[model samples]
Target chain A: MGKVVILGDKAINDGVSAHEEQVSNLDALHGLVNEDLKAVNRVILERMESPVALISQLAGHIIASGGKRLRPMLTLSTAKMCGYTGRRHIDLAACVEFIHTATLLHDDVVDESDLRRGNATANAVWGNKPSVLVGDFLFSRAFQLSVADGSLQVLDILANTSATLAEGEVMQLVTSNDTETSEDAYLEVITAKTAALFASACRLGGLVAERPSQEQDALASFGLNLGIAYQLVDDALDYSAAEKDLGKSIGDDFRDGKITLPVLLAFRRGSLQEREFWKRTMENGEQNENDFSLALNLITKHNSLDDSFDRARHYGSVAKDALGLFKDGPEKHALQDVVNFCINRAH
Target chain B: MGKVVILGDKAINDGVSAHEEQVSNLDALHGLVNEDLKAVNRVILERMESPVALISQLAGHIIASGGKRLRPMLTLSTAKMCGYTGRRHIDLAACVEFIHTATLLHDDVVDESDLRRGNATANAVWGNKPSVLVGDFLFSRAFQLSVADGSLQVLDILANTSATLAEGEVMQLVTSNDTETSEDAYLEVITAKTAALFASACRLGGLVAERPSQEQDALASFGLNLGIAYQLVDDALDYSAAEKDLGKSIGDDFRDGKITLPVLLAFRRGSLQEREFWKRTMENGEQNENDFSLALNLITKHNSLDDSFDRARHYGSVAKDALGLFKDGPEKHALQDVVNFCINRAH
Candidate 1:
């Protein structure tokens, strides 16, 4: 009931506010935290090194791919918003990226994926063995960097998050291609896998700034909801015909037999024949080229993609609401825009 | 020269010392720290758990598969021998094993291994995906456990060791099946991959006891050499006809194309035809049914197995000498015998 109460007017309002329209991308966050982001990049480059040539080569490839550095930016901006001056945030922010990179490398291996961010995956280029071991190397490097920061609290936050991330990935695997997967189970998986790291990154920002516990918790809440919003939009985009019109590729999750939100919603809302179709395509993982088109058509017919966007908006509003704890400032507004930026990708 | 000097008389003195016979196994070390070892086992069981059912099941399978608990025992014995009277050793010992277990899981995936300790590997039982994620989970748990113990020093030791271990694995991968893998390169891999963890485990044991830096260094030195001895003998046993007669499965390393000391030595000492054979079977990974017998013959003819044992004994002697800093006592004696146990497996 407590969490349910927050899903109210913010989720229902469809009108885009002026500020929300203006804040349609991560540019504001980047502008606010640009210098700190550069410092974080420096630390990341410096730490990914090893005597083993392939370790650095494969790690360097994936890391250099065009990621927005959104997660670490959250850490940097949150610390700045708290009005605390410290350099530890740079080191910790790099650590956040390192953890994310490691997860991506291993994820590619687990998914057997060939492309990431429009480039070849490490596993695809270097093979799974090197990718697995290099992921391990980067993972160990993240912990080493954190230990050097000399904060047990920081270590505790990250270590616990890392475990949660792994548990979430395993749960996703267990639930993959199973048509009967509940909304609650999918939420659990995304929250653990995606939101947990986001939460920890923002929490570390506050922690490094020596902010009060209440402020730290507020930032964590903001990050958690934002992450859920971010992933929901990502999943929805895979099925949105508008996204396809914009020349973006679609239907990776569908092809991989991933039982995501739109699929879950469509299956729950579809006819008996549609349910059988889903069972064949997703559960049994039998797909021809036309299956994705048909699947997207059924999803659009059911308004599943639209409903998924609505859900993303709800989490986005909640993410901005958590920013209410801080005073009026550019930092708060930029962070709010980050939430809007995440959701606007769907609109 | 300093290190080479310790490789003197102690290594060459193969006479059966009176105490060496009594210390034929790990019984002495186990008797000294039986209670601590039990507590460590409890911690290991407690920490491997997750809401994800497969994580605990897979972890339990590998952990309960009759490992001698040797790594943790090194931590436990080193702590006790250093006059530590705290309970932190149990938690830290468990952390050591978690790190080891995590490495084993990833190694199996990297190696495409099907068996470990005569039981199916977790990767073999659950597939590579769960095994990979679970390894990540356990690794994170190890860091969390260390953070809870509230010792940055212990965190530093374990974190550095973890990075070294990963680097070692990558280096091994880079050299795998390259019959040109230098003896120096092979040593570097095992030292980084195996000995580094042992060194850190023992160093942490001394650190927990609040011992002086010199004592901690000495303990690390002892563990480092012991780890090298352990792996060397393990590699030798894979080709030893005597060990094959003991009903132990052999030729796994051979089948895997691992470039260990015996293989490297045999390849170096072999004639032109023998070199051709190794390049075909190892570098080309083209082994027939009878190729293993031919390989073993070449190894024996070159005295590779005996030379590997000599290297193991040399490291064992250095390991024993590092204990000279400690007074003669049962804890010290037990640690010494643990070294002997590792070396005696070949004898």
Candidate 2:
């Protein structure tokens, strides 16, 4: 396990040679928390049902669409690592997934997205109205589960996280189509929109286990940094990864005029001609058949993908360090490997 | 006050001629809870603010658009009528209005409405994405307030109501564009989507006042009945009211193919030609400019409008009767007059 940690750090520094050894598969991690994950899946399936057939159909479409249930896995894994042996973590984990799924449903509508996780989005399949309404239903169900857990602390974390998530989304909307968006502004958006839920999900582990505040904060930091790294890799992968690996088309952000970190980095470092090219394609929404390939060339020429990957690795290291307080165990080892998995997956 | 009760019943039986004398104004009722309503408004304005400019702008545009704050007023009036006093009711009342406003924001997007309260809808002005995101923000804020109020019962009621609201919306979607939608199905939609919030809002008053179960149930009954009456009038008014009076263009539901009570009643009673008209205009979405007036004529010819009003009156009577447990006072009288106001306003 210790050698695995060194191999993870070495792969980050050396770049791609040790791919098989460094990139940890989720299978082992899932095996550790498989029981709780199944329970969480059951709760998700049970709660998604409604007397209104459209709701279950729309919600079931998205929930069953199989993007790795990463957020809930975080909750279940962290809970087990913190010595939480009870069933409350199962429900809480389901709540985390619900919040994540609700946002995805709305995000697809907001982004006017056609496909998600390699499947037609709810908005694409059923249209926008059911998507919006069922998203609201999933959100309410998430809160109901939080309340049923009967923890004010849990409720506070989730309520605040929900608000932050919305705020992050609004920030992204404001920042979209603007090439002048700053890295700091981008970080703020990702932290609020993505990392806040991750933080809350991990904190739920320590919260339910009655761990000390220090332990809870450590867990939150672990999830927060990991989430940031995960999103950074995702943003980078949008410009570079194969469609099958990404579960969606490459260059989606570019086509949609979304100003992600890769674009921001490449735009910052671009020559004057390259900047104008970005301005034409992104800001003015002008594009030709070859615009996507040209954008990729600009990103690669500027080495923005490597720069983004490096930043992701830094956050990944922080995430790994945050788990140092936990004693060595299978759960802790699996969680540490998750940080490796996040960063190395792009390789 | 006693004469007003008989006037309400007679107005229901005799129809529009007695409207001027029978229908009570809301000014007196608003006056009864004026201070609390003011406090609720303050909370609303304060909470709508966010560091994100778009959130406040979109939320403020809708929140300040001047719909009668009737739902919040119910919370205030019921709490006062229940013989209790506290500042908590003010926050809870604001929470009710937030929930209502949040739904309206999403509702306009789902229904593709351009006008609300005689002003452009938030969706119409800012586009659908902002409307959807801000609606989610306001919903989260409402739950934040509910959690702050620290009442498990309040949380339970609100959490359940939010889910039911979404469920109701999905039900409407499922039943939309289908002229065969049953009266019973329409009732279920209205009950869950519209009446459930009213019930929760009114029940909040008793819950906060620590009133007995009977009083709480009565308040819930009062609100449920009033909400039914209110929505029925709204459904009827879509065919009959002027744009200025309703604060939205008439025939919106007709254009959207929404199957409200009047449509159901008229469809059931229509001749084969009339039924064909409904099927073409509503189910087939083949609406012409003159179709609205023609539908109105068909509704009037069949007395479907009057019959729907009669059903609304029945609910108004139930709402009025629910106040029997309360000792008569200004608060009680104002509430009873609200029932009159609801029934008579359709004229």
Candidate 3:
């Protein structure tokens, strides 16, 4: 027991109180894993510090912005579920979160987003250049962290995931305005951009644990599915989530010309008029809230939202099935809970 | 013996006739570094190829817009100079070029200019989103290339340089609208953003060659000095360069409210009216090409251009002096040529 985890259940619950049952589930696991959680928190804080003053400031802003810190939690929980007894897991966990934060910062800048996590985005507050550069800084730091354990395998996992993430971002950037974006294309983009990193997080935990090869594969698969589920839910919430809950305007993605799965499905299923509405708003970047609501109406009429939810549920089930490959443990159960939480969450 | 030394008296003159110089350097280096250079080229092209058609199209657009691949050439030259026989130097060389290109793409977007390398910039053809995302993609690919070497030292060198580059960009972004940028601060920013990577390129070459520690230090120092001289000359050219020769618009930096070394010196030495003039134009981004002549007048009267030239010469001399640590050879002489070329170029 070289590392300790001091779970911040109270803090997380305070932020996510509306889902009291979900919070309770997380809290119970936090209590059980509390002894080992502190190491993760320490790794994150220490690794986020940089010689660059601007990076230090913006990295602090993002880290202290009070999101769920879910990716790191997944890494930690996966390692514990695998019955790991190593300190490297903390580094791996922090590395995952750093990768996530780096992407978030860059994404906000790319989206020219003003709000996230119920606060002004780093770009909105500090400016886009700092957000982009500090994102690069965090990414470099994450690479350093990934190599800390001298695991070439971990490096390979992260390096591939990082490249995939960038590729997905480029793909999304390209297709953001193209009316031809299909459901499959949207899935491919999100899986690469979002799910790939999440999958890497889980895979890295298994690697740190030195779990059996079979279990490691299962964990990675579980992570991949959960990531897909999580992103689908996010896409769904884009249409339904309030500005307060989502931290950005409703249809913000559409406004930014991002064609997510729900919209893609709706476009495919909609009549000529509905398709025209999407093209006019998203492709031309001409939509206001009124057009956005009309588009939502078309999505509902076509049951496109339902189709996206079905896919999310499918991925969620697959994610849980991945945990069945692991032996019964609090960590495994927590992983399962995460999968459920991803698909079911409103925001 | 494994890597070719591609050098000739006419190689630099090949810029006026791309065909003549292309044959000299690429073929000569290819013959000598055929084995390693091929691997390097492979890494670059392979990583650059995308399953998504649009990204690959955009990447091809920027990559095909030729510039003198000076930084990679240094890597190849130094690796051979230090007697490295391994193939890894090739990949490392290409990685340096990738990083350089990525920065150029992003800089163009942030600066919002149209021309580069005597042709269209990525942003000009594809828009800012593609340019930004592709820049990120190239960066990610460069890191992947670095990781392939499995050297933590190489990773650290590249990672630290990447961070420095980002920090430099942020610093520049912050001071872009300010007229009070000191020459020292200008140097500091360029050293981090531009020189650091050049130094890292040479250092990576030394690492590849596994040269003695002192020689490695000398190579890195040489690169830093040469890179600083290179950028200082570049900044000076913003005022003195012919529009056709410079590719980018003359005084484009001033138009973007960037306070480079000469401009900073000019502002400091100018009278109160001149200071007010600078504040309205360079600080407020109110200047036009009509103001270029006046700005040039201020620069010349204050001898700011001369001062900038002197600073460049100092860096060039330091760079040439650092070559004393290398063994006497044609490669060393060629390296010296780079320093002279950087400091003495008209454009």
Candidate 4:
């Protein structure tokens, strides 16, 4: 189930020694966690193998393409932090990943995206129809996974999160071409799209651990703040990232008419000429090379990227403070590392 | 909740009288059903109202296009037939309809269809992006509706049905061009795409009624057979119907490269000239005016349309037999009429 043997900072720095370090890090968590996590992984693999050949092929293509498994890690890490010894944590972990994956598949289709992680999107290769249907397949599979666990609270949290995720997506779609899109609206969209899953991950962990109500709240807050920070940094990177390292084109958001945080901030602070350019380009729902660079320039000149980074740091601080609710342990340290990783990851 | 009205056969023949009768029929279904159905309707309306202006506008437009409400009808009718006498059936009905509508929206997008039930498809009018997202919204809403019932069996049935439905869509996408699509595969597609939902409709009814497990299976069988029969008839109508009645062009499936039963049968039985024409035209996935006439000529020559209809009648008989497991009533008669109407309806 742990098909993701991620080669991140430690893997790059420590090479062969990193494997042992990874195993030791996992071992420091609950002993039962390994078995449950394996179950979750098995279920995801088994379910993703669709009888429909094309769907299975495309999903396998993407899942096999290395992702950090960050959402699942959050689920498992939060559960461990809350002293969860149960196996259902694995199901929750899978649920989190399924929701994230479904969004990615559909988002690619919606965006008409060609590249992701330096590879072809499902829609790019298989066509939008299969991608949409497979996204549906994964969504149903996720719910089935949750139902198998037979916990009402877990279902409620996951279900609500799913609704919130869709709402966020719809909101993003609406605001994509609106130059006047505000920070509040951007925050709402990000919170719904990204943070809801993160919050649900930790809250579901709390449920599995049978933690006190207050501790559950704390865990949820931790996840929400961490998710917000993660998204802000990711948004900021769209302008700053080199295609070779980031696996995406710079100013891709502007080219797509996506009014992300930096663009929204720039719109609020930039010159009249800059404002007119954004209004003309975004309001017309048209993009060209010139429009892309001009939009990027405004954001950079207004220091909106810096503002977004500061916000991400603020959220990272809040995420760290959330750890105070749990007992001191390696789980908390792992959670901290995850927060750091979220803000620092290049792709 | 019953926004649609069902006219009595007598009233349907009587023009103005039919209109009044239809209105009354809608009112009756709305009033007689428990509040559960109302709750489902409420959830559906609320959920479909996308924050994205374009999406919300299009969804409202499509839903307001006046569908027959057949899926929801089956759900409500089955629940009533089972003597459900509970509040949950409305939500289940709404859940099933939402799934159906979402699939319809996505199906239109995949098919690149312009007209559905004589109105412009959401995708055709608004664009694929909104259609796809709104479809997703409806799907999520359906899942939420199902979750509200808090029944594991309901969740399992709907979730599995969803996967089957999506698989059917994918299969349709893949096999539409392959002339070798067999009758068995065609049945498989309908069973997954159409019958599964219908069967679930009956099963939910049984569940709501608190009927014995044996009776539940019987109702499911009835619904599944009827649903398959309905689809066969619907497909047959594409060739057999007049444009004004079918609200689509004649030979629509052939034009769309959908290897339906009549065409498959005709390809099996036609003369070598006809076979060669089909092989070069339809099987080759190339259609033209001549191909249209050639397909019609073959259908007339081979009587495969009749053969397909005979198959539908066979399933309709099977559906009635399953209904014999229950006692007689107007509701029972209505259920029987549904099977008959499915086969006999013009569209």
Candidate 5:
């Protein structure tokens, strides 16, 4: 079982050193499932085919982009860890990736984001119309794939996760630019939008392996906590990571008036004048060149970044404990390594 | 059993009166399946609910709008025609409506449509972001409904239909603003986008009845041809129907550079100067106030509207023949009347 560690002012040094890993990438997890990962990539390429040229062109662009293929790999690795082998995981893994990709296409359009993975987003390259429609195409394609797999349970998980994904996105949309958004509400948004899919992906791997119900629940818990940690780090990175490592422009959240954790913390802890600055820039949408720097400075002075990292580290510990019942092996170790990689990115 | 009726220039008058109906609405179809229709409506109202008020707000606005629950009616009526007495049709019918409503939400965003059913569209009222996400939410909701229905066959149908719907929309995007688009290409777009769902909706009715594959095929064929005729009439109505009857602004297709059959025919049959006019207005998207009237005049000059209606009448006959194998009953008779009602809209 994992304990909640409330960090104090002096706990940042202890937390960072305790959670440090020599490697800051998913290479170990990928290596463990290297063969299965290749097979999953092949399935993605094969299934993304369409008679419509733009669909294939645009779908290929995003699928081939350097997205780390993290979600599908989770399914592949978790299925392997369960010690049951079948070919269904390959197709199901591809289906999971398809759902994720579909969400991305729509997400970029909703966010009006210009860059993803250091490349032009599909919405930016093609336009919102094609991105939206193609996203829809990919989403339906995933359902078709799952139907062919012929598992009512799989269909249930994917369908429920998809609705939650959209709900989360809508929740985020409603909360955006409202600096008064509560931490609970912000957590709800990320849990629904980001963590839901991650949890579903890992659970599906266990499902395909015909694992026991309790193990399925454990895998889901692992994924849910790990996903929360992953998104917390991602949100933190948007404000704190180097431009080259972030793969996107820094302060995009600031410019978009997004009410992320760091922003929420800074606003809650800011002086009267600083709170007005947040209200004008985030709520009223009045931002200038100096606003992002000031926002960043405020977040730093308030130790909001380190605090966010500490919170992610806590969730990471819970994710690891969710897998405590599984015996120590390559698959289990590799999965735990993924948790560290996600959290360590903030460094 | 249907013989294709290739109408000549002189065949317009003969086609119009033959397909005319005493009523111009779906009153008879509604009457036959009126009870099941009510049940389907209950399911829709109960299911579209969400904690997020805007999803319910936008979904309710469109669901309760006056657009004649035609697709779900197709499901209910067809299921009754097959003598299906189960409760599955209620939910599956609602599921079909959800898919259709989701498509409409996304379609408005893609077309940048301002008015639907003569009211401000969801996108128009709430902006594109919420509309897109809510559309995704409804799409997933439809899948969840089908999953609850617990039929892999039904899931396959809805999934395939969804992919085709999106593919058709993307094809339309590629073909839009091109005066050189062929009549075949235009038909391909509408058939995939509109007719695919209509086919699936009717097919699901037979499926829930546990009908034979042949009967399912017949229902699908009946729905497909009827759907094509429905869209053809819709396209013609866009050009020739009175503004009040059309429910949307006349010439929306023209303004959006949508290459429907009438526009394609008028463009191909026009003079070199007329071709350049289309280039400037439809392709280049340069239009003045008088241009719509000019375009209407050209369509009338070439009898494009009547010919388009004639084509719709032909498909209506094929749709009738698809239902010929079944014995005559209220469901059968009402279904046939729907074909006439669809074609006679141009009158």
Candidate 6:
């Protein structure tokens, strides 16, 4: 029997060189999936048009803002890996992107965020009302695409994922600004908010290819772990990355008092003074000019950034293991590279 | 062959007595559909519960705020009138109510209006973030119910209605504060925003009952015209009704600078001085303390309120004519009475 080899601590602990290799791998994967990605982009642009000029203008602004297109890439690459030869994956990939964009619009409104991906958010430019309504339009448009695809299973998964996404957002709202939030509670939030869609997108690959249930479940597991790892890296990067590199200002999570994983780890390892500072700033909203620098010092002192990355590496390994059933191919290698890229991106 | 009788100028000219008769007819129709409505109410309350207390609290506030459950009633009554015997209609009716409530939540956020149905809006009570998110939850939940019903036709109609509703809202946003918006433009907005759902709800009745497509189209036409009439009466009431009677303050449309049919009529009939007044207030949004009363005087002088109701009555007659294909029964009469009630309810 062929044994599945999972990336270990040594692979991740190699640090800068390892991260560079993963970045190059991601670039190669993007090149491999370039044609399918272009089709998905075409689908996205075609679906966003409406007789109402504001909708097209607002939706076009966000859709064209140029995020990594990672979610749709997951859908496209996974479907191709699973031997999906038909055109449905193109539409489904676009549907996944629409769902992501719709959430971003609403998320900006909910977060009252001004800038995203180094640009003014739709809410910031068009005002909250249009952002909220247009977000809804995109969401409806996503479902319209799902129905046109004529897959009850896809509709079921997308519909359930949407509800979970909303529920997860509400869960985050309930847990926001509460310094006492537990790791498990934080995990629950990320699972529902981020991982659910990822899992669904990956599952659609096996589902459309008519793979066995076991294989579909494996794809879903791979996606869920990858999503968790990706979000963990994102939380860690909030404290460690430069403003230009991260595409937004650092300490936004701090300003918003969001209770992310690194904060939780740092808080657990914090000294009495540091803990008190977190309570005052995060819980009581008593932030000041030097607080962000102080926060970095406390996190660095506790090695919380490294610890958070380690946790992400653990999930990344699990994601890698879940792909054991799939045979070797360019598509499979690209998906595996995606897992590594997600874990090492912050470096 | 029995000829279909359509209401005309003489019926509307009867005025108060005709309005009073319509109210009594609506009361009787409500009495007839009470049981199905109760079941739908139960479904709404049941579905609104969530582990997140704020979701249930916020959703329950709006769901129980006691607006006339008119949309659900349309679904239930039409389904029964079309000889539907299954429980799917009950769930579908609940789904329709959910879609309506979801829109109301989003609409309140968009309008930034504090009061709805004589109570604070969910956005007003819980803030806009929760309202926007919870509205999404309800919309998702509506789709969940549609999926559970296992009818692709129902899903198609509801999904399309949702997209059209969002498009209509965006159209309204574009046209807000623009005094030059044409009557055709106004009708287009109302048709997509309000009438599409009504048409869908009544069509669900035929779909669930497995009625012929011709009969379904008739039912849809009935609902479309009724919805147009209902919205016209509502717009006129914003100017002409007392606050206590209307359950909302007068001049809301004026304050928001929404270009409704009454304003359009008044603008068309106004002299140069009156036109300038509208341009200053409605277009430039430069309103003073006496502007609402001035606007009302202009509308009254131009007989715009009466003309708007006349327009409403015209649609009501079309709604009645569409129902002529259905056999005479309590369901049919109640539906016809609903058309009259929609037109005459402003009194």
Residues A5-101, candidate 4, lDDT per residue (tens digit)? Answer: 2335332211112244444433343243455556766867877887789878877877766455667767787887777676778877987888788
| lDDT tens digits, residue span B200-221, model 1 | 8888889999999999999999
TM-score of each: 0.93, 0.93, 0.90, 0.90, 0.93, 0.93
Lowest-sum lDDT 10-residue window in model 1 chain A: A1-10
lDDT score at residue A218, model 4, on the 0-100 scale: 91
DockQ of 2: 0.80
Candidate number with the higher lDDT (2 or 4) = 2
User: Per-residue alpha-carbon lDDT of model 5 for B40-82, expressed as tens digits?
Assistant: 9899999999887788898998888646677898999999999
Predicted candidate 2 versus true structure: per-residue lDDT over B65-107, tens digit per residue: 7777888988998899887777889999999999999999999
- Chain A accuracy as TM-score for every candidate: 0.93, 0.92, 0.91, 0.87, 0.92, 0.92
Docking class of 2: high
Evaluate residue B81 in candidate 6 and report its C-alpha lDDT on the 0 to 100 scale.
Answer: 91
Per-residue lDDT value at B227 in model 3: 93
- Candidate with top DockQ is 2
Question: After aligning candidate 2 to the native by TM-score, how far in Å is the CA of B34 from where it should be?
Answer: 1.3
Proportion of native contacts present in model 2? 0.83
| Cα lDDT, all candidates | 0.86, 0.85, 0.77, 0.76, 0.85, 0.84
Q: Against the true two-chain complex, what DockQ does each candidate achieve? A: 0.75, 0.80, 0.54, 0.60, 0.77, 0.71
lDDT digits (tens) for residues A1-347 of candidate 3: 00011123321232422235545556655655565567777777887776667777899999888676677877888887777887888888788888888888888878888888667899899877777778877887787787666777888788888889988988888788887787788888989998998888888778888887888888889888989998898777777633224233567777787888878888888889878888999899887758877877887788777778899999999988887877777777777777766665542
Weakest ten-residue segment in model 4 chain B by summed lDDT: B9-18
> Judged by DockQ cut-offs, is candidate 3 incorrect, acceptable, medium or high?
medium
Provide interface RMSD per model, one decimal. 0.6, 0.5, 1.7, 1.6, 0.5, 0.7
